[model samples]
Target: MIVITRYSVPEADSVAFQTDAATAVDVLSRRPGFRGHRIGRAADDPTLWTVVTEWDGAGYYRRALSDFDVKVQAVPLLSRAIDEPTAFEILAGGDL
Candidate 1:
């Protein structure tokens, strides 16, 4: 399963937001079934940020969110993500 979270932050808050995003990734990476994650800023809009993560399955992703460390370190940051669907099932893709 894949999760993509979008964050709309002001330029002045970019640094702090990135720090929080990094901490979220770090906390999630330590959870079971975590696959990988990446954080990126929109090329067209610097204030737009994203955190993309892949997991073994949807269950793993949900469980990870309930973890103590993740709750403390990641949830706060994640809460700032745009209010919209974040999870998805890949329909088609190719490895690089």
Candidate 2:
């Protein structure tokens, strides 16, 4: 599975940022190969918000990145909202 983690510092003035992110989450939830997503408010931390997502494979991930319009729409919203950027990982997980 592939994992992507997002730590966001949202724009001070735009409610649209959170709204858009939530919408994207809803859309992604309906897609094939989407495992799940988790979000949290960083603990007493002003500079962070956390998002984690799991996908079945690189192909599904790539399609989500390249083919989904909702995902594309998120770029500008994130740009306006985020301070740093999203982080990603291709994980190797199995029984040891």
Candidate 3:
């Protein structure tokens, strides 16, 4: 599986950002080959949230990103410093 991590950074409007983020998560999770996903936020760091998405493979994510709605919903949540997100290959796993 391919693991993609999107980092949410601070914004002028935290409420709006988070609200949009929640919706995006719901939408993306329904895409094909999206096996599973998780949302992470730090208690002491409001600007730091991680969206860990598990895909069937990198190709699945690439194909999903082609959807206009998905791109529209996702772009705003990304930090300016983050032109792109990071992806990893899952070597092992257990119960969540």
Best by TM-score: 1
Predicted structure 3: clash tally: 0
User: Which regions of candidate 2 fall more than 4 Å away from where they truly are?
Assistant: 8-16, 77-96
What global local distance difference test value does model 1 have?
A: 0.94
Report the candidate with higher TM-score, 1 versus 2.
1
Candidate 3 lDDT tens digits, 3-84: 5454556656567656766777777777899887777676877876666677888888877777777788764554332446
8 Cα displacement, candidate 3 (Å): 5.2
C-alpha root-mean-square deviation, each candidate:
0.8, 4.2, 2.7
Q: How well does candidate 1 score on lDDT at residue 64?
A: 97
lDDT of 2: 0.59
Please estimate how well model 3 matches the true structure, expressed as its whole-model Cα lDDT: 0.69
Of the two candidates 2 and 3, the one with more favorable TM-score, higher being better, is: 3
lDDT of 1 by residue, 1-96 (tens): 899999999999999998999889999999998989989999999999999999989999999999999999999999999999999987788984
Ranking by lDDT: 1, 3, 2
Question: Which residue pairs clash within candidate 2?
Answer: none
Q: What does candidate 2's lDDT look like per residue over 5-92, in tens digits?
A: 4455644723544566676666666667788887556678745665566777767766765646646664454344445434455555
Positional deviation of residue 75's Cα in model 1 after best superposition, in angstroms = 0.3
